[model samples]
Target chain A: MGIVATSFRDELLAAGLLVPLGADGLYGRAAAFEDVVDALARLIVSLGAADGAARIRFPPIEPRSVFDRTDYLRSFPDLTGAVVTFRGDDAGHARLLAAADTGDDWTELLEPADAMLCPAVCHPLYPTLTGTLPAGGATYDLQGWCFRHEPSVDPARMQAFRQHEIVYVGDAAGARAHRDRWVERGTELLADLGLDVEAVVANDPFFGRVGRMLATNQRDQELKIELVVTVASADQPTAVVSSNCHEDHFGAAFGINTAEGDVAHSACVGFGLERVTLALLRRHGLDVERWPSTVRDRLWP
Target chain B: MTDDVIRAVLAEHGRLAVDVAALDPDADLYQVGLTSHASVNVMLALEDSFDFEFPEQMLRKRTFESIAAIRAVVDGLTRAEVD
Candidate 1:
């Protein structure tokens, strides 16, 4: 919305990293963007290798039943997107065709599918870990395309995005330590990539009245820490990475437990791939060849 | 009074369920239903009402936890502007 943001959007469009669709928020990423994203994913894995996390890849769509258990609707009802399909018979098909001909709301013929687009990478993993943990607990590396219904003109904010996460499931102390360590590690990682970034205490964008209390409680408890970079605007930095301590929220909800039969505490560190790419382009211009040698070596080498 | 002004801003921009007047000076604005989205609106309104922008250091949760805290920060920033 600011002058800097407009120019940055134009830069992204011209660089082939982002292909702007006719719609406001939807944009197609070129190979250059995907190249950066893949390189960053490798960097994340290399950085996390010492932790020995079990690698898992999830589909973009999650089971609706599993998603319902997370109660995301209660907190972020506005951002959830459901997958729908046309499950109609002959009469329904005829009506749908009529609506399409009339240029009316043809989507009314579509019914809800068994799955919904995953809002976060960790949602499906929780259901998979629904039993006792091994010894001191477990750690996982997950990557997936995540969807949120938030549409914005800022290139930093996308309706659909990719997230790479390192998740820890264990005791409270272990989870907290994991979050703290990653908060520091993530800051150093971004700095290594030659971008100006800051780590700040933040809250989720919860919805409505009850959500206010939840957000305040989250901040008061120091549950979320975000690494923000100035991509769209200098005044309002966008969060490129977030380290969240869910405590026992997910563990209890999904019945995940420690070897001692106690509810496990959970923590996750997620890197927003597209956002980080945008930040790099914003900082070093669109041409990767012109970027600082140190940054090029770190990412490309 | 600052409390009156604070209450007016909350009433106009916040989605509170309780009466603004009945709230204690130290009452937690978030606990009484001031969402993060609405907090931004409240912050902008407060800046307009008092004619001073909040510094980055004053943008934390503690700064707007209560009417008293908001008043303290506003008074401090406005006083600094005068000096």
Candidate 2:
């Protein structure tokens, strides 16, 4: 159904980068796509440093208490996926197993919510704010394993993926500068990969009533932009990466007082490593050696 | 303990910074410019430089935030093995 589907998978694997994650025989649009995933990600952090963004890596998971503050759930409710464990009596476990065997989901039998579920596209800057700041504004590049509860049949859009975020948590001007630079630079870099991509001003998909207000506000502020390409189909271009300027949302929520005791705002450029790799593979044939000389030299070498 | 080792290792990675030693033992890794991806890069560099395997448990937060923290973990992991 897609470029990474069984039909075109081997074509991509011939590039020598696509490694199989499952036996679907779906030729996953990219070779060692996971390595490409990592390579592009490393490129992301390196870009952050080049743009003068401080680099930081958070735990793959975030504290639920903090995730609630950002209201990430309110916006990405559909993209929301979680990891939860079931604890119950042995009889209950046996019942659940039997139910599962019978093709009946026994999830309703146990507590739905208990420990921390994965944060949907959320990075933890709160823990990083130990009440200090540089004389100037600060920019940070954050990366972690992010999960989405919803699964897509498209290999490019996996249920679980990695995100490299370069955030500017400081003054509004600094935040804008940081986000703007990456939005432009990232598009150019993608172009270098020999892909035709565009940067579109976008917004977060907020959940309910409060979400409506936030989503609209996000759109108005032009705070988020996605690097989109026609992968699934030319008519329906999909977003591969995002660059966002989150103003003071993180600063106010995290009590991240600056050196002068002012809460510093924040912005970030997020790279969907898998999607980018998928885009690159779809752009060029899967053969690693045949990729653009520049991209090829950088990656394979 | 010297720049040559770190620099030589970093030279292998065209993009990643090689000044990992600049990081303090407890300084927040992000604060010292160590993004998670870069953390992996540095780890890879260490692996290549020392030519050994690091214990998986050491990959946790207790030892990754600072170079001193990483060195201690790597040094411990490397030293405890048969050379």
Candidate 3:
């Protein structure tokens, strides 16, 4: 007897919904798979169209200098990925080739590139929004590929994924309201798409001992909240959406001030595009055509 | 005393907007603009100055909320080291 696909990841691969590319947490999506993702992206844009957010699409990587200025490295050094390239002379290239020929680690020859793989879709936007805001501050509608170094076998936990985010920069009260409203809206949106969704307090995967305190502080302060759905199993659910209040962190770092002269406060609601698509697949089955009429209409219309 | 050492460490690394010496011991470090990023540096410096590593349980924000709080933790760790 052959092996039965028990895990959602295995089922996804077996159904040709996901194509393995010889790496954990990395895969190529089938056209149908990509179609679902596209539909979800469009749905998010349509939902937020009334807000008049300035739409911006960013490259997958951001400047290392800008990235270093942020606290991402201090908090999540383990999960941050930076781009490295060969910036050496011919002699160094020859040595690299020799090392590669012998199956030795040749990556030591590569130097740090000017960029780091963007960990969040909103990360690159802060630097551009420096200086004081005009009137009610700014809001942005953004979508971009984000990279994290967490390689996992869970299909929903892709290392490279697309994020659709609506970010607002304004006063502290406005920031909290933005995050709170999204927590409600995101949960409702996912539930409308035919997924059993729940909102819960969450924390980032901070690094080291000091990070524990940071994580605790973040949770205590209710800085982050995630919209979770059971994609794989009831025991292990995935966060498909996250609403975060940065609360002057980015304002202080980027020197963005409010119109009233105090430091600006910021918040963002992010949708994990791939994870939401995966949850739909897991809940409704691999075939999008056979999904419930209500779900199909919500996604397609 | 640990109080003076804590004061000096805060002056050098707390990155607070206020003068460390003039600030009250019970005043909130965060209220004075000691960011989480700066707090990590202060934690490291405290570890170095006292020659004792803080246990994981003592790594909460409360452990470093104020000069008095930091002094209490430092004294506890040093006393444990001595015992």
Candidate topping TM-score = 3
Predicted candidate 3 versus true structure: per-residue lDDT over A255-296, tens digit per residue? 899999988999999999999998899889998889999998
Give the higher-DockQ candidate: 1 or 2: 1
lDDT per residue, candidate 1, A1-301, as tens digits?
A: 5677777888888777789887766899998788889999999888777688889999999999999888888789999999999998999999999999999999988999989999999899999889999988888899999999888778888898999999999987889999999999999999999988899999999886546656776887789999998899888999999999987778877999998887889999999999998899888888877889999888989
lDDT of 2 by residue, A28-72 (tens): 334356767777877776777886866666666666666677656
Q: Model 3, B23-79: lDDT tens per residue?
A: 999999989888666777899999999998999988777888999999888888899
| Chain B TM-score, candidates in order | 0.94, 0.62, 0.96
Error of 1 at B48 (Å): 37
Instruction: Assess every candidate by TM-score.
Output: 0.79, 0.67, 0.93
* Residue A292 Cα positional deviation in candidate 1, in Å, after optimal superposition: 0.9
lDDT, each prediction: 0.87, 0.64, 0.88
Which digits, one per residue and each the tens of the lDDT, describe model 2 over residues B1-83?
63355445444432323354443445555454343334445656777777765555444334445545656666676677756
lDDT score, residue A297, model 1?
Answer: 89
Candidate with better lDDT, 1 vs 2? 1
Give the winner by lDDT.
3
**Predicted structure 3: lDDT:** 0.88
What's the residue-level lDDT of B18 in candidate 3?
90
Q: Give the poorly placed runs of model 3, Cα more than 4 Å off.
A: A1-6, B15-19, B31-34
Lowest summed lDDT window (length 10), candidate 1 chain A: A208-217
